[model samples]
Target chain A: MKADLVKTLQKKKKQILEIWMEKQLADAGLRDDLISNEELRIQSEELVQALVQSITEKNLGNVESSEFEPVYEILAGISLSRAKQGFSPRETGIYIFSLKDSLLQVIQEEMRDDPAAMYAETIRISKLVDSFGIATFETFIKGREEVIYRQTNEITEISTPVIRVWDGILALPIIGTLDSSRTQVVMENLLQEIVETGSSIAILDISGVPAVDSLVAQHLIKTVSATRLMGAECIISGIRPEIAQTVVHLGIDLSNITTKASLASALRHAFSQLHLEVRKKQKQQ
Target chain B: MEKIPILRMGHFLLVTIQVDLYDRLAVNLEADLVQMVNKTGARGVLIDISAVSIVDSFMGRIIGNIANMSKILDAETVVVGMQPAVAITLVELGLPLQGVFTALNVERGMELLRNRIDLDLNPEDDDDDAISDAD
Candidate 1:
């Protein structure tokens, strides 16, 4: 009886692809901009062929069997590519469910003469397609996470910048929340620049930081300590009024760290520390 | 017996740690450094650890102890040429080595030691000159 169901699906593979494509094309949420109809037809045909070839009599009830490996592989590939191409989860879900609908319709028509046989085959096919839908969602989420991880690394690279503001002064403008990992990057960059430029003073500008909590304050202190260890003075500048209030409210002791209200003041302090005087040249008379 | 050498120039003592310091080596260096400071009556001590890598918590404490011991013996300690990784590790280990002065390199460390000694001796020297003139 199961063999008969597999045979029916195998025979009507072309018909299933046709119905699946029609259903997808008719849907309002179909992303025609992202995927062309011709390419969609090729992907759908590949999935349909793989599914029918894998659905043998013995493994029809077991979607997890090795016989269905090819089908799952093809589904995973399609789902991952769609995710990278910016397909919505809803659209991917509908794509898998629509294929299930097409398969069940074909089975229903072939077993019309025997209602009991049709009911049994329908349950088996539904269960199999549901499992495939789950696999698709899993791969889709994995692909999206890869995209997010890459973007996070890029942001970490670009955000922490160490600028040599003067011959003996390096300025690092931190533009984000201060975390332990970011603190490590910021500290390393500042220390290395200090070594390369022989800078005795470093200015950490935190004006772009949105908020300051105890953890961030701890990171800042750690960075300053590390800089000092490398035989340089670190001055934290661009202290927002709210951050100062929060620090005082939290009772975090920043008395040891030299902080400035703005980068200009930090620069002025650095000059005095280095015994460097930047005077405006006299205008030619 | 492996020993880290302490070189004395004028009123300052320079110790360059060229090997990775183990516990025994660090302890011996600490004892020897303090003894040398007392014996020579040096005004400043500069330690260059640029070649030494891989510092543990014990090493961090040893460095801090050396600075504190020297301070008590009337000598200023300036640690110089600390690698970035070592500095980060020391900070993370919660040993900032407070009261320890630092410099970028040996040249700067030497300059710092000279400047600190000069600052401390300037007022006393003026009094000595006035007394000599009166005599």
Candidate 2:
């Protein structure tokens, strides 16, 4: 039994070794000369690839490595000898700064926009990261803000609802958490619509909103106030029982705002007040 | 969406406001209603704002105007359903709906009206009020 166990273990290791050798040889684009001995090549290549992948993964997972720094990692592959890990965010910045510094030198070298030179530059950029490690919270938020700014100019820092009542549109169904930033955009859009539409009614349907604290409720109240000022109206709909409880718990007063069970009900109120009737569910091809 | 109970008050008109009693919407309410009255030819008025979460100073003034409008149109006016929150928001917002007809509901409000005491609420009040106001 002992001898059999040893043989099984050996066989397993041998199989793994063979697999490793095949992978590495393929990666290195090796010909017959590289695999003269299958067992030996397997043993050697597995160790090399393992070492490279570990180093790449370790850098990405390490969060303490300066938040500004972009980490790089190297991945071992069959086609390419290896791939680099993410560079520290800092490193990427540095690479760009350095490239800017080298504008004159690059022109002198007559390699302006040269693809091969660009690839080399990219490879240099990859060397700067410890790995694809965790990013700090600050970095994540900053990155998000940057993305949002690029996406919309209408969005600003304030979350107050803007109303333009004369326009006639009824309800703005807002679903989701109201981060201050998102809240600002919602306010601007709603207010403008209210004034533009001359709508006698508007509803803030937050049924899909998962949670509400004092801050969110406060924002809603502001929007309602803004709407009423224009002789337009505002209704808050989709206040789940849990959320209602939460608002009460937080000592938030929602009394002045019209609260409804759902968006349909809110719309009903709007139409009722406006004495409006339209064909329901118009089908289109 | 807030559902305001829309009932046809007898000879008078009663608007059951079902929202915060004292939200900012209450501000300039008298002017708003007066404009509506001028356009709609509404006689008597009952602003049932029981849905009011709170009442504020600005709204209190508008309520006052509703009662005042009664003299101009020969109609009676009353308000109902004032919530604690409304009183607070009104105070905070510094709104005051003074002299508006105050009632707990349509029953009490209609009881305060003469001649229409025995008659059911008339939808004409609402239609006349809105249509006249539009003109």
Candidate 3:
């Protein structure tokens, strides 16, 4: 009975592909934008070929068997690629489930004379294809997670920028919540820039920082002290009223470090330390 | 036998740590530095530790102790040329050496000492000296 099922699937492979394509095309979730119809046909044909080659009488019902490795591999690749190509989960799920419908239709037609054997074979194929659907969804979500991880790394790299505002001064504007890992990045970048530019002063503008807690305050103090240990003065500017209140309410001591209300004041303080003055030029009459 | 030398320059004493400091050697050096500062009546102490690499909590406390002792003897302590790694280690060990000053290199350290000594000698003359230096 099991051998007949595999044999029947191999014999009606072409008919199964045709029926599968029709079923997918008729489905409301079918996405023609992410993949063309011809590409979809090719992907389905390759998956079906692998599925037939891997199927055997003994392991037809055992989806976990190594004999189904090729089928799972092909399905994972197709699902992940579709995910990368921006296919929705519903579209990818429909693509896998449609195969079951096509296979069952062909099996029913091939075993019209053996009703009992056909019913048992349909259940086996249903379990195997359901397992394949679960694997596809797992791989598709994994691909999406990889894309999100890369974007997060890119954001950290872009967000922490050390700008050399003056010859002897560097300014860094932080624009998000402060965390320990982010503070490490901020400290390393600022220190590296200080060494390269030979700057005497560094102005850390925190106007873009949204909130301040004790932990964030500690990170800032660590950054300032690290800069000072490197023989360069660090001036933290952009003390918003609320953040100041939070710092005081939390009883975080910033007395030993210099802070300014705005970047302009920080710059003025840096200029005085560097013995620099910015005089306005007379406008032409 | 391995004694970290404390050399005297003018009214300032210089101690350059040229080797990794073991616990006993660090303790001995602390005693030697304090005694030398008192004997020389030095106004400033410059400790160059650019060559010393590894620092644990014990060494950190020794450095802090040396700074505190020098302060009691009326001498300012300026730790100079600390490698970035050592500074990070010391900070992680929670030893900021709060009362000590630091500079990038020996040259800058000497300059800092000179300015600090001048400020100590005549605080009222600092403004006149600064305006003249600016001109």
Candidate 4:
């Protein structure tokens, strides 16, 4: 009986491919903008061929067996690529479930004369397709996570920029919420720039920072101390009025740190520390 | 006994730590540094630790102690050439070495010491003038 079912699926592989493609294209969730109809047809054909080739009399009841490895591989590749192509989870899921619908419809027609065999074969085919659907979902999620991880790393790399404002002064303008991990990055970059430029003064401008709490205040203090340990003076500038009020209310002691209200003032302080003056040229006319 | 050599340049004492300092070596250096400050009447002490990589809390305290000891002897202590990692570790250990002066390298350290000495001497010159005016 199982052998007949495998033979029946093999004979109707092309029909299953056509029905599956029709169902996917008809679905409201289909993303015609992301994938062309020709490409979708090729992907559906490949998956149908693999599924029919892997369905054998011995393994028809056990889709998890090694015989179905090729089928699962094709499904995983399709799902992962769809994920990368920006397919929604529901769309990718429907692509696999629609194939199951087409396969069951063919099996139903082939076993119409034998009611009990048709029922049993329908359950077997449903279980096999469901397992394939699960595998596809797993790979889809993995692909999406890879994209998210890459974006996170890029944000970290571009966020912290060390700029040399003067010959002996380096400025780092922080523009986000300060966390401990980000603090380490900010600290390392500023310190490395200080060493490379041999700058005697550094200005940490926080004008772009959205807010400041005790934790951020602590990170700022740590960075200042580290710079000081390297024998360079660190001046924190661009203190918004609200941040100052918050610092005062929190009772965080910043007495030792030389903080200015703006980057210009911080630069002025740095210049004075280096005993250098920026004077304008006398009017000659 | 392996001793970290301390070199004297005029009124300044320079000590370059070329090896990882164990507890015993650090303690010995601390004691020896204070004694040298007393013996030479040095106005400033410059310790270059760019080569020293690892620093525990014990090392941090010893550094603090050295700065305090030299300060009591009327000599300033300036630690120079500290690695970035070492500085972060020391700060995390809660030993900022508050009283100790710091410089990026030996050249800056020397310049800092010269400026500090000049600043200190100029006040004494003003005091001397004030006393002469009183007389």
Candidate 5:
């Protein structure tokens, strides 16, 4: 078994194999020594990445995205998450990031007349595509947002139901459990929309949120911080009791931020802060 | 509209609506669905449109309405089986459910409904009577 393993290692890297030979002669345990070598470690990582790249590049156009499951995990764990998914303004931008090109390509290819099924698929892959990639994230989010924008051709930039309100308030009623990438998109869109709208308050109501994990909690914090940089407030609403527990257990401190039990309550707070009250029709719905 | 009983267990009523074209039904689907949901009397509902070829702004609005109506009636609504173009269309249109439960697939939608609505034999609230179409 040892000889076979070494033989396999030799095929991958002769230089590492030479180093392994020296370490083997000096050490009593070959398994630990071989694995702990810096050269072999680098070689293994390179080989793994190369293997994945070859698989992805070769089969990207031919196979369905589901066929690239192993690649997605590797991408998420490897270069994409480790080096690319960095925090800070430098990484944020106006772009659509999508790693699953196979799915996106299919959607774009069929968008003309076969739009109904295409829209359906967009929702399907929107769930699968990693929310981190600028291209993928943009495609995923814009795909969902497109329908809303296109609904009324006469809709002004400011009239969309979900948008940044005046007085630095961004009323975004979160509809689903957040993952890291979607969190990024939300952060990006909110910040950009704030810059454009000059809003001071961002009320995020997650009452619709069904589950909350540590990552989700972290994403929320990051969103809050990002909003703050744009000189705006991010008010969270619809925080369920269970979500509150998850936030606390995960050691997320949200004390300084404004939170409400529901969107109605948050909007009331927003109006009160703005010192404005509605007559009836505008506030009725 | 092919109705597949994905989840018929207890309080969970999972159904996949095969909309080869959700667009074809977008015009009246929203109101029709609200009525169908009320008629079904299911505490939890999932609409699977995996076979749908596209999703538009009107389609997205219908989804949003379904979610809101579901909540008003104390029922949970989940939109499932969306494809890639549908995702782009939704984001572009910006009409997805603001507070709706959505899943990648039908099975996940079932799991989500199961998690939200406690399936018990004891019907404490007359949830069925709450479905209101009053405009």
Candidate 6:
């Protein structure tokens, strides 16, 4: 009985492919921007070929069986590629469901003479297609997660920069919320820069930071003490009025830390610590 | 009984910790350092831990104790030549070595001690002012 269904699917493969393409192209969720119609046709054709080749009598009902590995692999490839190409999850879902629709139409036409056989085969086919659809969605989500993970790593790497503003002075402007891990990165980079430059003064400008609470205050203190242990004075600048109010309200003791209202004032303090003066040259015409 | 020798350099006592310290050894060193400070009447103490790699909370506390003891005995303590890894470990362990002076190396440590001692000794001369207004 399963042999006859497989044979019918094999014989009507071209018709199934044509109908599937038409269904996909006519769907409102079809994404022409992410994948062209010709590329979509090739993907659909490859998946159909793999599906027909892998279906056997023993495991036709079991989509999770090892016999269906080739079919799953092709489906996974198409789903992952679509995810990376920025296709919406709904669009990818609709792509697989449309194939199911096309196959059922072909099955109904082939088994028209036997109502009992047609009903049973339609149920089996629907179950198998449902499993494939779920697998495709799983792989699509995995691919999107990988993209997000890579972007997060890149952001952390590029965001923290230790700049040597002057001789014996290093500046680190933190631009985001301070967490324990990011604080570790900030301290390591700042301390390393201090050692390399032999800078006696460091200015931590928190101007870009969006908020400050007790946790951030503790992180700043840790950073300051670490710099002190390295024999460099850390001056925290860019204490916005709101952040200052929060710090005072939280009653976090920043009294021991030398803080300035802005980076310019912090630089001036650094110069004084170095016993250096910046004077403008006389104007010449 | 192994002993870490404390060398007297001028008015400063210099200690170089060349081995990873166990708890007992750290306590012994702290005790020995305080006794030596009293015996020598040293005006400054410089500790070079560039060779010591690991520092747990116990070791950190011992270092802090050494600084406190020397402070009470009227000798300023300057911890010098701290490895970056050791400093990071100490910070992570939540021991900031508060009120203890630190320098990059022994030479800078000596300079710091000298500057501090000079400032301490010159207050009266500073008040004496203008060298008696003489040429």
Candidate number of the best DockQ: 1
Report the lDDT tens digits of candidate 2 across residue range A23-92. Answer: 4445433334432456335434453334233323233233343422222121112111211233344432
- Give per-residue lDDT, candidate 2, residue B2: 30
Who is ahead in lDDT, 2 or 5? Answer: 5
Cα error of candidate 2 at position A42, Å: 34
Candidate 3 residue-wise lDDT, A1-285, digit = tens: 546788878888889999999998998877898899999999999999999888888898788999999889999999888878988877788789989999999988888888898899889999999999999999888877998999989878988999999997999999898898888888888877776787769999999899999999989998888778767889999999999999999999999899999999999999999889899998999
Candidate 6: clashing pairs of residues: none
lDDT of 4 by residue, A1-285 (tens): 646888878888888887788888888888899999999998888988888887788988886699898988898899888877988877888788888889988888888888998899889888988898889989887877888999977877788999999999999989888889889999999888888889889999999889999999999999999999999999999999999999999999999999999999999888888789999999999
Task: Evaluate all candidate structures by whole-model CA lDDT and list the values in order.
Answer: 0.91, 0.51, 0.88, 0.89, 0.55, 0.88
Please tell me how candidate 1 rates in CAPRI terms.
Answer: high
Model 2, span B20-121: residue lDDT tens: 544444544555666665665565677766565544455566666667765576556665544434533553364434334443345655555543432444
Arranged by lDDT, best first: 1, 4, 3, 6, 5, 2
Interface RMSD of each: 0.6, 10.8, 1.6, 0.7, 13.0, 1.2
Docking class of 5: incorrect
- Candidate scoring better on DockQ of 3 and 5: 3
| Local error of candidate 6 at residue B11 (angstroms) | 1.0
Whole-model alpha-carbon lDDT for candidate 5: 0.55
Which residue runs of candidate 3 sit more than 4 Å off their true CA positions?
A111-116, A282-285, B122-135
User: Which stretches of candidate 2 lie above 4 Å from their native place?
Assistant: A1-145, A148-167, A179-184, A277-285, B1-135
Q: Score the docking of each candidate (DockQ).
A: 0.82, 0.04, 0.53, 0.74, 0.01, 0.56
Greater-TM-score candidate between 1 and 5: 1
Return the candidate ranking by DockQ, descending: 1, 4, 6, 3, 2, 5
User: Residue A77's C-alpha lDDT in candidate 6?
Assistant: 89
What would the TM-score be for candidate 4 when compared with the true structure?
Answer: 0.91
* Interface RMSD score of candidate 4: 0.7
